[model samples]
Target chain A: MSSSFDPSKYPELKNLLCSIDKIPDVSDIRPETVTEKVIECNSNCPDPRLKTLLDNLTIHLHDFIRENNVTTEEWMATVHYLTDVGKKCTGSRQEFVLLSDIFGIAALVNSINNPSVNGSTVATLLGPFYTGEFHDIEEGGTIAPAEGPGEPLLVTGRILNTSGEPIPNAAIETWEADAEGLYDVQYSTYSEPDHRGRFRSNDKGEYSFRCIVPIAYAIPDDGPVGDLLIKLGRHPYRPAHLHMKIEAPPVYETLVTALYPRGDLFSKSDAVFGVKTPLIVDFELIESDEEAKAKGFKKGPFRRLDYDFTLATKEESAQAKEKLRKSMAKKA
Target chain B: MSSSFDPSKYPELKNLLCSIDKIPDVSDIRPETVTEKVIECNSNCPDPRLKTLLDNLTIHLHDFIRENNVTTEEWMATVHYLTDVGKKCTGSRQEFVLLSDIFGIAALVNSINNPSVNGSTVATLLGPFYTGEFHDIEEGGTIAPAEGPGEPLLVTGRILNTSGEPIPNAAIETWEADAEGLYDVQYSTYSEPDHRGRFRSNDKGEYSFRCIVPIAYAIPDDGPVGDLLIKLGRHPYRPAHLHMKIEAPPVYETLVTALYPRGDLFSKSDAVFGVKTPLIVDFELIESDEEAKAKGFKKGPFRRLDYDFTLATKEESAQAKEKLRKSMAKKA
Candidate 1:
């Protein structure tokens, strides 16, 4: 045998040698290999649930990259956009949450985690403006201190269980934009407790408040999220709606939902994807002055809406509570 | 005929009325519907390329969410992590680039953009620390300012074409970590021109530099990226190597690459996935003071490495240039 081996004598070796200088396909990422490496790295994660979550996330993310064959420039642009979204987030603004809302992720997650029970109200996005605190108002009192625009309206609702029995003293938090399509938070010279209030249902589970009928309003669009919406040729307008957080006794799962007017132009095309058909109600027009006065309304031509909210059973509520607790605990 | 006729006679109508009050699945986000809406929003984008990019991105992102069924908590955690990563970025630090590197995206992009041509040296990641400025030194000069603890190293290299012809006057920029395994950028007390320099090949396309041998070093692990590495059960160590950017006249595509020492602990498992087998070179040991002195060194023990870099033809170089130009134009 020769001390030195010659590759020229072997056709297979020659072919391999010839390929040594060949140019590789630029977009070839070897996604399978990359996915395996990522999974291996996360294999020893201390939390099994977290490991599973990361594993699934990695698989999905890698699959997306491979499926799209995303180029370097496209990936960098995404990074820049995401960074801008983060940088835009402040104490009063959360662009990421806004992004989630627009993508329907928030609504989807809310629905998935809190399945409806019987005829209980369905939960929706909590939204970013919830302050967890509102000025208390007497039953059937006016939530709006000074109405700037839109039609005068009266909203009356009852909180009950699936059995059609009233739940006395249920706490209700409600807020909506004025006729000018501006939330109290959006006003530069605004004060606390204007066009927003918290009220409690009476022993009969009847609650009422007076305000201007809500109108379609655009979300704040000066930030990165707004830019994205504009790029997508999508309007930022949400349908005319009222946000409410109802907490009744015996059901620990709080119901955070919005009630949309049935005839709003954007009712079926809410920018935030926060609308549901069941949550839509008609703002009935009441023109009889005498009947309006009997209902404690001083004037005629006011819109009236009556909606009844049902709470889920205690067992159902408990299951939702457990699920939320587990999900929250997984973060730690 | 009575207006209220029929419901009593039609059992099916009665059943439909009863079921109308049933609670719906609140979190029911039809991903297909959402995807379609998003696509519709971007239908009028001024830039067709942007429209395509956004379309693909939205599809992939939505698919990932639906496939993984990511929970609200998990999504929030991801948001928080990305926000932190952005917040940590400073003028001298770029966490996102590090993330891309660790994920093998950087290497993939570099390889894709700059494919090897006729045995020309393959390009690797430019890395985050490359500032595009290096102090020019004469040929056969030392890059290291002071000898540290590691063995002395003498590196000699030639710049040539695929046809084995010398390509004289090739500008080469080289950098490496010191004996303490710290790049100048990583040291708190570091100054300029330490363990890094720029030089040119002579008439025969030969160049030489003296320095301390490099050792494996851990990447910056004091930030969010570091935290993620620990959580993923991965070490942040990069294999011992020397970085170089070689550019010759008429070749617009500057080759950015690195040469690794054989047998490094992390050679086979570089944290950034940047190591390529062809880039590894053996360091021959010399143990005679007379021999070292003959090479203009006064030391007894020294390691020597000799490697040749080949440049591609004009056509191959032009292709890379066009690709990069197109990529850059997209950003603007």
Candidate 2:
């Protein structure tokens, strides 16, 4: 779009040339109005659900800017920090997930998606450590390979329906850190997924795995998220817990959850806010050499955990999913 | 920090144990309470201003999540997109600055820092194109160097104080795109800052330079911010304008701003919202070879701009700075 101008030389035209559109007299629009307009514009998004979600997000973001009166320099700094978090993510590490976990967003999402049904296991955060490439272990086989370091502990559980019936052939996927508080994938000494495996429920709806009891550990702190935690004066340790994802055929939905050892120091202050009462279990000491020998162990004493996980009927799961969808779709 | 359990009979524990301080059971806190605690925890930030800003930001971010009921997948997607923007940044390109520009944040900051003072020239955004490395050019000399493309034009102005007295020897830094709407720095063909330079005012506070009349151009839209603008159905074109940053000795403060051509299509709708009423000027057609010769131009039929910029008193500038600092210092 070109400015209107005459190429012809004329004394009268000279005076008019300098006066054309010379003043930007447009009224200033408030930043608040601009934010509202942005939200309105996104309302036409193809996906109604996504539009609602984005609209709310935009509003909160703008509100935050206004409330904080954020400066240009501060804003740029935040943008840079977020970029760092993204760049820090790798196949083995998910910084964004860590951010979500520390902020309690992961737990919120879990609760929203998997409401506690009468007798079902209380869902907790899946955390940033699940590799999903777990090998299938024979019933009661050791998931913590001989090479990994941790006290021998056995985890046994039963999968059952709300009606108290056994959910035969259910898959129970499990993973945990070594005694030193490092997940198998986090080790520089190993390249493969260690101390993580899946086991099938027996005809009696029973599943068990030999692994080390997880120790309380700090989330990765060498990144931007860690820097933020330090700045906020928040500790980064999560209570010792075992990550699990269980699934059964048509009767139940996939459940991603975790179980924490009872009485952990960081339990009340779990850094990621992923702890739940029902998910915490007490480990009992067993000192039978005969039992260890029968279980194919060359050792005597072991810590044993016996917990049963309950699943909701498919209808209950569908209801929870629908509830979450509706809640996420709330229009501004 | 070791778990209080026997290790003698457990020979396996002796070899594998690593002092597990394992326990995780404690009463659960609601996510809402967690957010509140996070905000409260920041009350001890050494810098009150930073603490307030962070608190407000955290509140809004958490509110956005709660209000939108953002799903895990959506949150992860946003994290990924932000990371992409950071990765796209380099020495030559600042995607974050471009983002701030598109969101109208840069304009808001400029306006906040430099409110209109009596006759002072209005300040606009110092866009990402400014490399901060401007070469000094002699009065009436061409700033296009020898290789850029555009029709010849001349800009002449006087720097004056609010009382209308000339401010001699002031430095005026100028930059803009060529006829093709590409800034010198935006072109790979030119490795240095071309079509951009600084010039000093003469004895009577007069300044002049030879350059191509700037054309309307789009901000870089090959990144996430551009994608956002597209998604928001917003145009990315900025009005044709010449960027300038003028500074004088003690009595006057530095001014970073731009002057727009009258009647440009984007004058009223500048992409970054950098346009203001007093910053637009008109260009007069100069058709006399004799007059062009007198003005140190080798060509006729060139455009000439005649304008004077006014500066604020030092007292006014100091007040603004103090106000900004105080505003940025509010805690809790």
Candidate 3:
């Protein structure tokens, strides 16, 4: 049978045999058999959710190749693009998160995990700059200290529980770039404390601060994330806003909200796409003369914004936390 | 107002004010208002699809952050892992595809795109080892030309339309590694012409090939794909099989099929989860001393496999191509 068997009859078989011949003692592996390797590796994924995810992913990915007849080159290009996205991350930023944000998966997951509460403010994506601890401050204090530029403004807001009761001692940590739209951390010329402030609300659930109104600004654009934005034809500007995280008892629910100044062109079109109608408020202009004197200011023409936040019920807030924990565990 | 605005009232405000005094104006292109700047630059996304996506992602991602209060360090690790996955890709391989495959997006897309035809062979994911262009040979010729190892076998298969009508003069390209489980492209030790071959069907839609029986083997390790397998605690071996592509007249649909060696353990549990019952076949061992002599072989045992491929109807095939083209155009 060996003598009669014609190797030329099966070209694939011939190639396999030839390739195998070059390596001593080891046999040639067929292309048709590679599927098992892929399946086995995917099936044992430690996280059940991830295992299921990988399993499904493998099937579609394989089918994509078969259906589209994808070539080796196209596949390689995708790899290179992803690699650059990873290389772009810095200490304060993450490009992968940006990728996820653009892909809609992150949004989908968010929607699935975070259902709206009756009265609590809806949470949103924490932009890359969230460094956990913010300094503690007293009520009616100025969060912005640098005397650089822009109209001086007195911003006041109250934090309330779901039942409409005020949370007098709520901690509101606020951070914003200076009038030129630069964070203290981003500038070498600025000290560690520049442009970021942590303040606590008064007994009446009211907190006020004095600072030059911050200017709308763009995220850092010199990295790969910027390159991707260029490729996608997107500008990087975010509307003028203050970053505030108000945390009280778990019953009140923590609120991570961005207050966008009304009338910014891009307010309706935030680059990271994080604008809610409820979050937009007018930074009412105050002519410096009379109002400034009432507040004991010697100057003219400033701005003032008064906003109030209501939280969710304690049980509802706890449920949100539970849901979040499950999702994170699944992800891990 | 200046006298009433107490910077010391807000401790958090004091931190920001005291942390740094000078914020740089790097670009000189500052917006007039902070809210305007945030809306214009921080989240100014344009693509409607991407805009919606980012908005939702931010909400959910933020919720996750607030729910677990994810620390900066944990988030940094995720960033690093993603970067590593990106760095793993090379010219011939894609770690992202593997990542997507494991994540299930690949399989989902495949199922969404490739609906199966009734009675025709179901399509499965194309495992990674595809290279372009195969050498063409006449019908009834052997693809395997070298004297390598494995039980001598004759594989005869027919290509037919969905109506069970045979398609004449169909070009069928066949290739597989030898018993050792290595392809010519992977090994430099073997000559280029060694194990690979292509053959066209005869007028009767019949093709035969002579070659050694293929053995199941694992995919290549020593790469990111391998590292992933090790991390997931998976074996990389695949079941034995042959790869064949049957393409006839334009009216007939082209079919890419893999014939799995029956009874292989990995067949039912293909690593990539690509196994389908219809694609499996048995290679029956026969005692044929006399038959071997007729074929000029001094052998007592020989192997034979007889299989047939049924394609979708001409019109159906054309419709499939049109659908595929439209989908591809949409993606492009």
Candidate 4:
């Protein structure tokens, strides 16, 4: 035991331990010879987490190369495949995000970071195509353009403090797909602006909006991200829902929530895994033509939803913002 | 201790210690919220190694976000950027592989798995663009079809077993850039179908090929991978070299190696970190007009290199192949 522990023999022992003793002469080796080359090349990674990840990756990658005895031609094919994925990105869509989403990394990160909440909204993947900055509107004002397609929806929601007391004023930024299930950002044919708006609640802590009930649609699939999904046998559809961010005074929490249409097939299996139980609520189908007429909507029928949000206290708000800022800086 | 552990009095503690308790309302909790999230998220990671990595990554990611307090627009920009990287991949070249290279993932993986083999050749990144299926050529034949730009070179090498015995009939595959420092695949102008070729050693374990000396060149830019490199402040160049792979009988190991030309500055800092000390060899500039004339080449000068490679024993060869196979299967 003592002999084995001798540090003076480390060089030789390490050779044996790593199984590099009697190193092969420079010729007559397999195509997998590059495996060691790769491992040696990446040895300098400094971050411990990255170090471990890379190390494990190397072992697996090398093992992969050797196991298949991968030919030089096959390796080259992989390179070409990856190059196409890079060429497919555009302003409106990202293939890589779809790649990550399909690979489960996006879901994994969201799941790891967002713990469950009881009697409150659950967080989900924010997705890759959410364009920020919305036109602010007054409470109860109609935000969706008149020409946009959708059954008028009267969306009313309250911003409440953690103690269940109403917060007098809160800003709620909302966006969603049109009746045809397409966001304005996804279609160039639509007007420069449609189907998205921001509203501030009144002193009564209530905000309302009028827009058509959005449809459920599939994520884009004509790109490399789509190709990968097909290769992996997965669909790219997301459940129907309205995205919102509710913010009040520093004492109240800012809620990033999505209210899904009840009983959508994709509600249980969101592509990015963003759905939470609390965020699932009923979209009541009202048959009262009188009610639709009172709201200045078409006389056929309408859907209505009322969502109440509870915010965290002031100190928590500051901390959350600070944490988010730090993470963003690091990424930059 | 009993008081601190009370379920009714300290709901957060109770929730954390046992899964039966109600989900803790982490929102609006102040600085502790971030810390709690980190701990909670890390606790769910199943892999012990990954768990530790996630813990550190969360801390850093969170810190960066908080420091920058990045707007949703900026976050969306990042998402789009990554998406483009995914879209850029084709069937051959992978932008993500290049991304990983520039971000150090490639090098990190290389080093962690390649323990030092004192006398054995070191490996490097195979890169995102190495296509296989080289043309087959007879021993003492040429890989170059046309003059192909560079001065003609006579490369001769030997394949030997680990015990120093010559291994006859070893297969060798070779490829490299021309005088312009571009592979045929990189340019549509080059119509040389057999620029790359595979050969087998003679009974004396000797092999020779006629080809132009390859020059150093920069990796491709003008894409998302390029943008990332610019952001990270890195150059994209590799030194002059010839890529070679050798395989023989089961008695010895198989080898994939690159023979770098002596006196290239970038050899020391190969962008892909593929340089190996043992693999570096001198290509003599033959000034003998008589020698050049005898070889049917331009009379003033040419280059020649002689290299010999030794392989490990059979058991080691099997182990390496097994490892490679496992890794390759995982990707498939």
Find the candidate with the highest lDDT and give its number: 2
How many clashes in each candidate? Answer: 5, 3, 107, 91
Span of ten consecutive residues with least summed lDDT in model 1 chain B: B1-10
- lDDT tens digits, residue span B109-151, model 3: 4333333465666555455554544666554445565345766
- The worst-scoring run of ten residues by lDDT in candidate 2 chain B lies at B16-25
- For each candidate, the DockQ is 0.12, 0.23, 0.08, 0.08
TM-score per candidate, chains pooled: 0.75, 0.83, 0.55, 0.65
Chain B alone, TM-score of each model? 0.82, 0.85, 0.68, 0.71
- The sequence of per-residue lDDT tens digits that candidate 2 reaches over residues B1-332 is 24323335333334222333332222364535656755554443456776777777666776677666666677767767766776677666778778766655566565656765766888888888888877778998888854345767789989988889998999899998877777766676766777888889899999989888888877877788777665554556677889988899687878888888888866765667787768788889989998888877675877899889887877887686566546545532
- Candidate 1 interface RMS: 13.9
**Would you list the rank order by TM-score, best first?**
2, 1, 4, 3
Candidate number with the higher lDDT (2 or 4): 2
Candidate 3 differs from the real structure by a C-alpha RMSD in angstroms, to one decimal, of: 13.6
For each candidate, report what fraction of the true interface contacts it reproduces. Answer: 0.15, 0.19, 0.10, 0.08
lDDT, candidate 1, A192-213, per-residue tens: 7567889888999898888777
- Spell out the clash pairs found in candidate 2: A24-B277, A264-B23, A264-B24
* Candidate 3 structure quality by residue, lDDT tens digits, A128-173: 6666645555555565653446667778778877667888888787
lDDT of 4 by residue, B1-332 (tens): 00111234323334333542222222222222444443443343335543443344444444333333334444446567766666655554467677656544454444333322324445555565557767787665677754555678888878876566778898887887656666776775545445688888899888888787777776666678665443333345566778887777566555666788777645654556666667778888898989876665656587889888776665754565456556656755
- Provide the TM-score of chain A alone for each candidate, in the order shown: 0.81, 0.87, 0.75, 0.71
